[model samples]
Target: MSHGPFQAQPTTKAALENVAGQLRQVLGLEKVDFFPVVKVLEFGLPSIFENFVFRVKEGPAMGDQHGLTFPDDSEIWLRDDVYEGVTQGKGRDRFTAAHEIGHLLLHSQRFLSRRMGDQPIRTNCDPEWQANCFGGCLLMPAILVKTCKYIDEVMDRFGVSRDAARHRTKQLNLSMQEVF
Candidate 1:
């Protein structure tokens, strides 16, 4: 949901989960539920990859937007408030940072080379949806969530908002009696 437009890149939720897991491994956080998403935005990713930039921009008002990523530019921008909230461990802002990281990892121009055409955009092939899928998997990892006994457990253990944990329940199609 950060970028304006991107070429279709066919992918599945399973694929995005794998990507997020790999990123966690790269960040040495494979076994942890909560890793600092803002720290990754500020240091981890940019340090791991060349020319990748993360900035907290002050001006032009981002309005409702929490953060945005320019995949082609290898840059991620956070509105000042978003950055502040994320550093303070606000669940929503953490997801926003993770979401922007998802966009960077999944939607770089080189990775999605097909130009826009007359084809109808499918959700599975959408850049924004893909990023959401990735971000969800990264924050509320399926393996960990599967072990939780209830919704509040997912929210507490994963350090994500209730909305995010509910979305995960839907995405994973878990039994509502257990996780709904």
Candidate 2:
């Protein structure tokens, strides 16, 4: 289940598990809970390690409307406001957590050599898509995604967002246009 350097294989559930296992090993996330909704962060990678420190505020001065990834520190910032905004229900928070974890495990390496003052806020290689792929697989896995058939059903089963489900289909190399 290892994708060596330079392989173009599509993302799979097993691959996601491999990434999660690697994270567990690398970050020593033993006490951390693995679920869709938990708010947590782990630090690693010497150059980008400092970015794991989260700066959060409760009321009115919240900044960005979306998540932020710090390549220099290999950290990801998720706003509570946006998390609640993306997930409306109480129990469905796991999907969001998984998505952030996806960003950490999948996209962090790609930015290892990047500088802090880079022009583009984020790379256009679809890290979000990659993270979504990881999140979908980690949250639901292939066996579960296969049984649902419909995108909405996949969304419900995975407890992921509509966008996450669509990207998951793409990540799994499924033609969504053909699914309907």
Candidate 3:
């Protein structure tokens, strides 16, 4: 279960933006069109999810487990509630889905390259943190966030939760006093 050194580097804002920008180009997305995240995940990156299985099965309680990706075949299993929430346009669900996608993009290579055994492999870097950072940057790009007049606008435009929008604004150190 030792993980390989695939980008086994610390997560940086620059790296996250680079990946998000690449994804935006691949999905033909504009900076203002963050609402179409689910569509991009379903259509733009079909190859990643198409070749493998994606099951929405019952699992841990909400907030406990959002999604799981099988390294052996790149299969993704999401909790039924979370899946329903995502389809229903819940902000938390959208973030969770993007978070799982982050793992796929950021950590799948290492998972695929390494051999799995009973013991779990520990790495110096935290993949979960990296994926979370990716998800945030993907959903709320710094360029777009900087243009937002208020945090509410970011939430409304991006379909992200209030907390997420606020956190992103704080992360980018964007002033919320002016309105555009």
Clashes per candidate (backbone, < 3 Å):
0, 5, 1
- TM-score of each prediction: 0.88, 0.51, 0.77
In candidate 1, the residue pairs with backbone N, CA or C atoms under 3 Å apart (3 or more residues apart, or in different chains) clash, namely none
Name the candidate that leads on lDDT. Answer: 1
Q: List candidate 1 segments past 4 Å from native.
A: 1-5, 113-119, 176-180
For residues 1-180, what per-residue lDDT tens digits would candidate 3 score against the true structure?
A: 122333334557678778977877666674554546556555666654567556677765434667876544656567888888888878888888877777767675543343345444343355666677778888888888888888778877787888888778887888775243
Off by over 4 Å in 3: 1-8, 48-50, 60-63, 109-124, 177-180
What order do you get sorting by TM-score, best first? 1, 3, 2
Judge candidate 2 against the unseen true structure and give its global Cα lDDT, from 0 to 1.
Answer: 0.51
Tens digit of lDDT per residue, candidate 1, span 2-110? 4444554799999999999999999898889886787788778988789999899764677777888887788988999888888887888888888889988887776
Enumerate residue pairs that collide in model 3. 1-117
Model 1 RMSD, rounded to 1 decimal: 2.5
For residue 103, what is the lDDT in candidate 3? 74
TM-score of 3: 0.77
